[model samples]
Target: MIKILKEVFQLYIDRSDFFLEILLQHMAICGIAIVIASIIGILLGIIISEFKKTTSPVLSLVNFIYTIPSIALLGFFIPISGIGDKTAIIALAIYALLPMVRSTYTGIETIDPAVIESAKGMGSTDYQILYKIKLPLATTVILSGLRNMVVMTIALGGIASFIGAGGLGVAIYRGITTNNAALTVAGSLLIAVLALVVDLIIGTIEKFIKRKWKLN
Candidate 1:
């Protein structure tokens, strides 16, 4: 174990630039996917809550999407997007939708109906009520989902290399092919660390949102 750690440390020291490049690729893939997913998911979530009749069907479909295996889903996209970061980003965005959408839906749906009613009573329009009441109250939950989506995307981004997308997974796959356990371990450790660091940052944002809303 110590020897492996030493080897990984040595690898990091010897190949810092290469590792940094791989890390950046992984971050870029995750970052882009998360942003795209956030816009679509949040919008869908808002629409789902507004159009009550569509909620059941939409939730069911999103749940079904969550069950699809990531690799299979990625492959399903290859014929269209044709393998690369674009394909991986699309797949990650789809997978990320479930969490973001569900959270957004839950966040708004769970808001106190009385507050909305009060807002309406004050001559607030539908848009005003939603923007002021629903969205503000839902920020913490939405942020929580965002946190989950970011971490999940980062973790999954490692596999993007399988589709010719450059990332840390390249190191992992190369290590596997070359019988280099240390390289595999290093790649995996870096991915895990990246996920952890991002999660922590998101978590901090969540806390700030909670405090802003005095949710606690």
Candidate 2:
């Protein structure tokens, strides 16, 4: 194991450029997917929060998509996306929806009804209340969901290599196929570090937002 560790460290030193390129690819795919998922999830969340009757159906739909196996989801998209990062991005975005939507809904619904009533008594319009009050309070919850999605996307980005989406998973998959423990370890470690870094960044932002908005 020590020898394999040394070999992996050497691989990182020798192929730092290629490793960086793969890391960029991973970040790009995950970034795009998470952003798109945030928009869709938050929009649906807001709409469902307003129309309480629709919440169950909408949540159920996202939940169904989330429950699909990653490979199967990617496979289903293969025909249209034709085996590439596009398919991977779509799959990851779909997978990200459930957490975001659920968190947004929970956050909005959990707000004290009396607070909303007080705003209404002050002649606050629905739009004004949403923007000024509800959304501000819900920001932390939404951010929490985003954080989870980002971490999940980073992990899933590795699976995208199976569809030729070209991330660190490529190295790991190749290593597995060729019994190259060093390469596999190198790829896995890079991914772990990347996930940790992203989580920290998002967590920091979450804390800042909560403090600023007094959402705690």
Candidate 3:
């Protein structure tokens, strides 16, 4: 075990650039997916809240998309987008939509009725209420949803390797093809560490937001 550990350390030392490149690629794919999904999700959430009637239908559609297997989604996109980072980004974005949308909707819907009433009593318009009352009050829940999306995207982002999207997944896939256990373990470990760090950062931010808003 010590020998294996030493070898892994040496591998990192010898090929840090390769690992760094893989990490950056992974971050890029996940970042793009998160941003796209977050924007669409938050907008959809706001729309649903405004309409109320369309919330179920919209959420159901997003939920259906989430249920589709990631690999299958990739396959469906292959013909249209072809294989590469673009396809991966689309898949990851789709996968991320459900949580973000759900969280946004739930957060907004669950806001204190009294708070909204107070805002209205104060002559706040719908837009003012959303921006000042609902959004601020729901910030923590929305952040939670964002964090969940990020973690999920990072976890599944590795599967993109199967479709020629390069990242730590590529390293693990290569290891498996050649029976290189060290490479597989190293890549997997790095991914795990990355996910944990992201989760921690997001959690911290959420806590900060809650405290800042006096939502504690």
On TM-score, the candidate that comes out on top is 1
TM-scores of the candidates are 0.97, 0.96, 0.95
RMSD of 2: 1.4
Model 3 steric clash pairs: none
Q: What does candidate 1 score on TM?
A: 0.97
Per-candidate total of colliding backbone pairs? 0, 0, 0
Residue 45 CA displacement from its true place in model 2, Å: 0.7
Q: Write the per-residue lDDT of candidate 2 for residues 33-121, one digit (tens) a residue.
A: 99999999999999999998998899989989988898899889999989888999999999889988998998899999999999999
Per-residue CA lDDT of candidate 1, range 1-216, in tens?
999999999999999999999999888888999999999999999999999998999889989998999989889999999989999999999999999999999999899889888888899999998897899889989999998888888888888888988889989989988999999999999999999998998898888877776644
Which ten-residue region of model 2 has the weakest summed lDDT?
A: 207-216
In the predicted model 2, the residue pairs found to clash are none
Worst 10 residues of 3 by lDDT: 207-216
Better of 1 and 2 by lDDT: 1
